[model samples]
Target: MKPKIELLAPGGDVQAIKAAIIAGADAVYCGLDTFNARNRAANISFDQLVGIIRLAHQYDCQIFLTLNIVILEQEFKTLFNLLNKLVNTTLDGVIVQDMGLLYVLHHYFPTLDIHASTQLTTHNAGQIPFLKKLGVSRVNLSRELNLREITALAKVGQEHDTLLEVFVHGSLCVAFSGLCYSTSASAGNSGNRGRCSQACREEYETTESGHNFPLNIKDNSAFFDLPALIEAGVYSFKVEGRIKGASYVHTVIDSFRKQIDGYVATGELTQDGERLYKVFNRDFTNAFLRGDLNQSMFIDNPRDNSNNHLVDKLKAEKGESISVVQIHSAQQQLQVDKQQITSSVDEKIAHLSIEKIKLSLSFASELDGPLRLTVVTEQSDSLLPGQAVKTDSQVFTSSSVMIPSEELSVDRQAIEKRFKSINNANYELVELDTQQLTDGLSIPFREITTLKNELLSYLNAGVAMIAHVQPPKLEHHPKADGPLGLSMLICDEADVALADMTDGDIYFKLPDAYKRGCTKYVDFLLQNPRLIPWFPPVLIGKDFEVALNILQQVKPKLIVTNNTGIAYHAEQLGIQWIAGPFLNTTNSYALLALKQGAACSGAFISNEINRQQIKQIARPKDFKLLYSIYHPILLMASRQCFFQQSVGCEKPRIDNGCMLSCDKSTSIKNLKGDSFAIDKQKAGYPSIYNQDQFLNTDIINDLSDKFDGFMIDLTNIGAGDRVSPDKVELITQFQALLDGQSEASAKLSRLVPESTLLQYQNGL
Candidate 1:
């Protein structure tokens, strides 16, 4: 069934919002001037946002606030306080891009609905069920999905009882959400944390081209691909023009409105939707939505004199043959033929002409032989009833074009292969969870065994990993499972590797940097052989030379870095590498783009993706699913962690570097008591640890199909949110979901059943 499509628009200021709403938008998303992810846009003030919310409500429209920026520890207090006040307002859920913000909001304002920001880079169906479990009521599917993929995701949402939102129209990013670090990489301001400088908007190409051509050359140009997606299946059609003028808002919204209404009536959108494109487009190509990034898509000079004629020629070619192919209405249908016409014999509908037939409620026609077109209209015309008609040959005479089989083959293979793997082995382990007592109290031994037994049962039930929120001590202690490591207990990064290291006794892994350069560590690893590195940091001293020195001496298995930095250094020293989370790769092209980027062994990516998207980003052989799922994906180089800067800022107070105001959260309730911001005063360091976007085992199963291993991150777990048993269960369930499934499999979350401890041992 066609969705009740909503035309969502961006509104940076009052004018744009008014223009978009007046132009027939169903919803609008924008931000506050201070903390919104799009800091540079003309964001409204808090007061203004409230007013806008009320006004939109009055208009029977919805307002999605943009708290889409990654937050710093200092900002939490302010953010919490602000949200505390806003929760009482008439606004709908805020569009949140940051996981830390999501956690805070979920803890304090669980009743508040959350629309996962596109910045989260949610690109797969497996991600939907987990998002629903995380209390995400609605999701803005990633901008990267093509039409067919979105249709499947919509099906997934319907299957899992989740609402899917998508971008109908918007500013298309060359990079995945929050992952485009060009600004942060060039300057010091990180886009993930809300201070992007739009470095991709610049244009420069290096004359000296090495083995790598385009990447070695700088290419900064705006790219747009909104229209085709809107015509597809994005339920909430978003327009990317918050920074644009009211004219832009009005024009774009009007064009989109027409297209959406057209789709509702006819099921097809006209080609070359140039309304917004004319306003401001970087010579649009369907971005990667076309399945390949063609060179023609890059618009080098908007003012190039030849562009107009070229565009005109393209438009002329596209519009050469407009034919009435088909019409569809309840209980009525008509067919058109080049030679003649056939009308449905309902006498009331028999009197429509070709033009009226084109606009009738039901009709069908063969166009160019292979193209079967169908259209539906709101009302039937009696003056000229639906009929079969033929167009003048002159209409299509000049529009003959050849279709490239090679290009079609490549696209078919890419999309088909990506979808084909979805049915591979998969399942999810669900664990009963309890809140963590920060004072480090352990759970009762009897309770621990009961949880362990439940995990073992699931493993026996063909579940690969046990997912639960038990402390590492309970999950891994020899006595917990009677000295046998049954199926692996899925765990976050803090514990997964750590458990392996301590003879399967510890769940949290320590930093491997201390272990890498030391001979003692190497000898110990050689002896133990079962140890694994968790949350390993790539130590870059001054530059790659120091890293090379360490690598030669240590001969560590993996070295990680950003693509550019890694490319520069790796080229100097020949070696395979791992793309770190810092790279922010969210699609296949980016993954392929980075294959030789640093000669990566595997790539690290943000957890904002589901299995299908991960498969696209990394081929089966090269992807590593590190830190499977963390709530609120954080983009920080450990070198830049606020804790490393100072010791005294741990006390919560208004200070620089903090983006949140905690005072406003006093009235807001938290599931885990009143959650407090990290105290920077006593610790001499900021208490706010980086928040991770929440992900679960089901999403991990999707990851397993695409990547080699998982990284269950619990860094924030111990520091502030601290890895809890629930988070650990999430990891365990992911493993159990994958262990023995023959097809894409999932264990519907059955609250961990009561069971007796069963011991089974496997030697490493």
Candidate 2:
């Protein structure tokens, strides 16, 4: 008989922890008071963590502590000291994401088990052996894998005799689990090591038409097949809800438990288990797991402000249960002929005629329907449970055979239709090489205008604004003249105060990065009355203090704080605040939720979003257009930069920070002391080296028409590195082109002029 799979639940708070245990969870994962994954959760203090561990152990349940957040050099001493104390406690395993942390846990707490967090983005089989060698007991596979992919991966784990864990239920991320820099790009909060602002939850507008869209919704509101993945033989099932209420966590975990049991016993997903999304799915999306769904998963529109009927259906089914059972035989194992099976309602008999093997089974049935039995054969004659089975038929050997379930059938048409009608928003203009700009790029202007008019023609169209793409440029110029026209300069107040001349009206920015520690500077600028302070997202703990002392001392025109942190201070001060794009106000709910802090929020649309989805968000709130186009999401590191040392990589220092240089670009990433070149491709695209960049030159003109400010995301630009001539040139030319000085702008107009220039323009 196979070992029973462990059911793990997230405990963001103490109540959530209790709920998980009550819901029949075998184990619960939580964070300590400081430097754990949930920065906002009222995490367990050191003493409380120890108490929780003891309490969990008393219940015969296991407790997995989270030391998963990214660590900095300064915090190493304290972190290791904390780890040393934890070693004496009943910590079953450490759920870890950072390689540096992994190294520490292994060296100091060598007896401690470690489970790789999903944040590690362990997507392929190659990582298994590597992790296994590092004393990792289990791996949480990337959430983006589909049933087939996950099952295939499970086979690898089985062959290697390692444990595999997967997200069986709860909130699903739109971006790749660990690869997303959306939070870091929008705000400086990093999610890789777990200080995230949940930026993906915000809404945005489409690129073609500036229609607003909301991202906040229930879990599984998009297109995930949780039931299918559970049946794929994952060793452990994980539920994501560390930030949610206890009821929500309990409801989600209990539901998945039933689903897993049902599939295991009956070889079928019970209706209640299959439809768990109806309980609390924001919008269901299998993400990359189900291949690719054509539509955005969460589709609540702010403009309409109507409750989702789909969500309502799910909510109605909340707390419904599903059940699964473990099957075993009192008699010996059964045998079966090729493609043959035998079973009774009360008992099951499996016979392998060729091997002359037979087995009998008896177990409690969890399904509401009839008891079903299945016998599958493998490639090799060794019939071991959890091992990959291949069909070694004399006729021809194949990979696997499935025991058919009477209750399940594949719906080809439903799957196809679901794919086709996913999301239908306007297309964003691809950044073109102005150098490659020809009649093709120019003609798109007419096409976009036509599209705008066509959308507005219908009263039911619900289109709000058209997202226009602005041309690219490198530097900010106050005065310029040409055929293009006047340009908008996105300059900081420092730039304005330091400039020799102030003839042109430049949009003054209060960069959340540089001016974060100074309130006096903000007060001085507000007194000048000449500054247009465009505030971005602000931090909560330290930066919050900076905003309070001097924010009310001066009356500023606008403030932006995404949905969290400093915006609260800005709003309480009665200043007109414009919400930042980091808030991700994709729909009405998001807008309403974020509106308490700022009067207006900026909405950005990705190429994957659709116009209808945009309309879903625009109808609710007053949004001031920020940058029409968003550059590549940038990774921001609050953790210490990995520039100078090899301390952790070699000896497993408590403080692990290292620099990584690729052929394309140089970057610093935090990892466990036992880190290696896991996968350069995943660390990020060679963005600085030209492998990936958000230089949307072709779409610039289109974005310029809809946004109040155009943007260039340079957060990833290394602090010590020299300024990028290409970026400066891109901004300079973009301003020139926006100002109608086409000749002045022409130099920086194109990116990769040789490839897809014409083809992309034609598609637009």
Candidate 3:
């Protein structure tokens, strides 16, 4: 049976949230001013979030807050405080990315529903149970999954009682969501933290294929695929754009709402979805959903296509070439459409309010009588300045008041002082009437405090007061004596000799996608026992099965994998596996989750953190921590081919053969004269890398005691224009640096002069 479809919308600001509610969104996901992924959006405040929750629930729409960024060690205290406040509110759920937050919420704030962020990069079926075990109720599926893949995962999700959400309409990221490090490498901003600079949309120097925006693709839309998505059993259809304004949010949500309703009721899509073009968009594509990777997905223009689309439509209507006057006319028509959308949204949302609720507290006491308190809450209105309509009232009675001798009498001042803190994000408790308390009757100070707490509990709709949770005290587990042996990554079989000569473990880099029933890798791994199989970050459909087959056939003692699907399966097979660097391990609690979730033996600390951040992570008992000291800096990895618009591919679309035969390398220079390497390896996805390698030797001296091992990449996949040094020399020098030889650093620097440690310095 198909799951009920939920139309989810984005709310960047107050107006956008209101617009979404009026436009008939079933659910809306927004971010607050802090701790949320979208720092660029005009995020709301805590008070506004409280008020917005009230307004949205009135319309039977749910609200999910975005706490979708990776958690740092030092920020956990503030994170806990925020969670404490959130647990007391009527918030529907929280969409989260950090694993540590999951551990905390599952333990402390059990009432808060956890929805896995798309930052987790959930794609394969294995990830379903992996996240479900961590208390995830719903998951935002990866943007790259096709219909068949979605159906398969949704089936698994149903078995685990986990809901799956897909991005049906929005801007499409060129790379996988959690994997891209484009701005983080160049600047301190990380997409994992929601400070993406949109490097993919930037205009680049023209390539041989005559394109300026080679990396930018058209926006995503599945208006016609609603039937297929519903048949796939997906639970939610999300629209992506928290940075877009109310007009854009309202127009998109309203159009999708009618389309979904018409299709569900009449079994037909009445709307042609042309209204979606009235607002901001790059003309849409559903190629990713249809599982057809084509050249048409790449758009030369990254900006709004509405004006251009209108011009084209006008040209077709007149059956003539586009004139300058006609172009101006089209621009005017687009503006009128935009203004009409804005006006319509403004009118619809005018009745909804997010103002702070006003509290009227009345206190009365007589000689030897129990203290009496009446709490009345009124809905505040800017239009009604002096008067407010009562919304809620509750009376709280306490133990009998005794004659006052030692403690101060319960006067108006004492009553006001006891409960003033209720004037907070949820309410304003200013109108206090305590005329009868002047009779000089009082209770014990502790009793008064308890009565105040009871009032607070009553005001919060019968929720008991939650005590602040202090940070858990964890015992530091140091690494065992003796280095866990230095390591190097290589893609070729000929580099095995360097491992023996240099005294380092050799890891064989695997391909992202593989042909079905291929046994070449299985045979190669079986023959060469020295090389440990290192799995890539992505493996979908037949590729995952082939990779799993290799794992079963080879039965190696150990493997390194970046994909959680592989990690999940390896844990069940009892194969010792190390969580690769791409897993984005940051805080100590994340390490604990990995160990408990998969019995993981070791993991590579993400290079995006600095020395201080690295030292703060407390290693789990018997688990080894490692770091990658040297490698080509990967910016993005994409399912779509960059060569289609960069160097020009003759094929109109890419298929499995493109993965096995196409190996192209080119560099695109930005307007600032900074060049990025675009490399496409055979049987791998196209990737962008920084020109300079990430060579950070300081960690050797700065905090060597914190890690058990170090790694260097000897693969030539990311070396675009610059020729790499000999693999043996790289191994020798990196090994010497581990041995504390001072001169080895200088020697390695001379060999590879262009390198960067921007991520290490920034310490996200």
Candidate whose TM-score is highest: 3
Computed on alpha carbons, the lDDT of every model, listed in order, comes to 0.43, 0.45, 0.87
State candidate 3's TM-score: 0.96
Q: Where is model 3 poorest over a 10-residue stretch in terms of lDDT?
A: 381-390
Error of 2 at 441 (Å): 98
User: Model 2: how far is 212 from its true place, Å?
Assistant: 2.2
Candidate order (TM-score): 3, 1, 2
Give the alpha carbon lDDT tens digit for every residue of 1-764 in model 3: 33478999999999999888888899999999887889999999999999988878878899999999888888888988899899888899999888778887877788999999999999887787888878899999989889999999989999999999999998999999999999998786888888889999999999889999989999999989999999899889999989999989999999999998898888888899889999899999999999999999989999999988887888788877668897897799779879998898887777677877889889887767778888888884423324445487888777766665535787877877878778988887768888757465777778778888888787666787777778787667989898646888999777766778655568999888787899999999999887889998888888888998899899888999998888888888999999899988888888877888677898999988888898888998999899999999999999899888888889999898998878889888888999999999989989999988999998888988888888888888889767898877887888788877989999999888999888899877
Flag regions of model 2 displaced more than 4 Å.
Answer: 185-187, 205-211, 214-218, 221-231, 271-280, 301-307, 310-764
In candidate 2, what are the lDDT values of residues 246-329, reduced to their tens digit? 655666666766765676577666644433432334544454455543334444442222124333443466434311111112
**lDDT of model number 2:** 0.45
User: Can you give the lDDT of residue 140 in candidate 2?
Assistant: 92
Residue pairs in candidate 3 whose N, alpha carbon or C atoms collide under 3 angstroms:
none
RMSD of each: 27.3, 27.5, 2.4
Q: Model 3: residues >4 Å from true position, as ranges?
A: 1-3, 321-327, 380-390, 399-409, 443-450
Q: How many backbone clashes are present in model 1?
A: 96
